[model samples]
Target: MEEYKKRIVKTIQFIDNNLDTELSLEKVAEIAAYSPFHFHRIFRMITDETVQNYITRKRIEKSAFYLALRKNLTVKDIYHQFGFSNHSAFNKTFKKYYGKSPSEFRKLAPENFHKIQNKESKNGQIDTVFDQYICNIENLLNWRNMNLKIKVTELQEMNLAAVMSLGIANVEPSYNILIDWAKTKRLFPKENVKMLSVYHDSFKVTPPDKVRIHACMLLDEPLKKQEGEVFPETIEAGKFIIGSGEVTLHDFEQCWVSLFLWMKENNYAVRKVFPFEIYHTNFKEHPEGKMLVDFCIPIH
Candidate 1:
């Protein structure tokens, strides 16, 4: 079961990386080294959506992200970029999910699209409502009080053995499990091993209860076999904007928000890859109960 899940995760990562290309069931199943029929059934069982539905939904969500935040991209440019055959099809699908046409959504979503409710009035009063409620991304600068040291640097590729944790509430337990596995495998040394949590979905896009993350331990080399739910993954070498600081639990969100604001202020474009954290100190052992961490976002 663990090995099966690992394969599915690998395929999901492949799908995310190649959203602009053709992704048939056969092609995706090959990534998992599974027969298409079996892969389809397993995928539905695990992710609760058919392969095509998942692909379409992801494409729509990505398109929505661009429409809301990337003002430089026109509606036509976005639709074509996400692999839609034509504008008509893209509009129809987008409206079915978001209850608004692409242009209408673009007009309304300034900072975050998820906050936009589907309660448009008959008399264009929705514009007034949106104006009152929209959060300006510039306001995120308020988090500067956290005094995070942010920098842009190149990161080497890494190999990891990871355990999936669904929802924020389950993160600690997943990490505990991963640590125990490492102990049994003699992967830990006298010094603290590097631990990381990779975000596979955006908090702004997915519901908090349904968000997916991986609790991972950096590996010197790939593991020979899957142990329990732990499986190997690799983070590609890339340029990243990183925010490093000592933060309490309450400070995590603010740190992330500030990093994104910093990225925007410095004119950096985000790459379509997972953002992650590297833990340098365990909060439980710190005198002030603060964890030293580095939050890294891949950039184009």
Candidate 2:
């Protein structure tokens, strides 16, 4: 199982690195050192998307990001950069998913985006990196005299079918809703559905009324369209520090607190991208069993 997972991770990395190049089943399978027939089955089981669909979605995601986050690049440049053959194809696909032209999205997003950033950072006083929320001494004590096993890895871009939880009092209810949604949709075969948790706000910094969390499933298929709150998201490629442990779910907050302190102590600056958790075991299936979770924290 570990060996197969390594191969899948390798293929995911390969696809991310070559998003600007040609990618095909036969080619990607060869890169994974597996026959196309075998690779297709495992790849879908592990990732939830057919090879072709994953590439298409990833290309669209990269282009949309360029449109929104980058000021210098034009739509035509983004079109070619993501390997789209022409502007027409890219526009059609972007409109289908985003329901707006690239220009439309770029304008709509920034109106609310930077304001949110400023609000998160402002502390009534002058804005500083060590805001009152992050300067707590108790959080530092959580890491003192503690031993942790950490692995720093470069993870490939991950596309998720997520259920957004905004202003939820606790993370558990959101996770329950996500798992139930997965079961109703037949998205879990143990091997196919990977239960991942994404934290978009700092509990210490963001107020409970404004916190953001996502309960997500890694895909082997394109995200199914639904009228409910489920949405699609992509975490861009980056280097991350992974910390793993088997612990009671209630103690999970400590895990992150410890890691943040560890990052500060080691002089590692946190990346703007959110931190996420990848669960290795299904805890609902085993109440007595603690979870094996990897804290995927982006770093420079």
| Candidate 2, residue 258: lDDT | 68
Q: Worst 10-residue stretch by lDDT in candidate 1?
A: 126-135
Every model: Cα RMSD to truth:
4.7, 14.1
lDDT of 1 at 210: 48
- lDDT tens per residue, model 1, 186-239: 887537689999998766555465468999999888776667778777889999
lDDT of each: 0.79, 0.67
Error of 2 at 153 (Å): 0.8
Lowest lDDT block of 10, candidate 2: 112-121
The residue ranges of model 1 lying beyond 4 angstroms of the native Cα positions read 26-38, 68-73, 108-140, 222-228, 286-289
* Model 2 accuracy (lDDT, Cα): 0.67
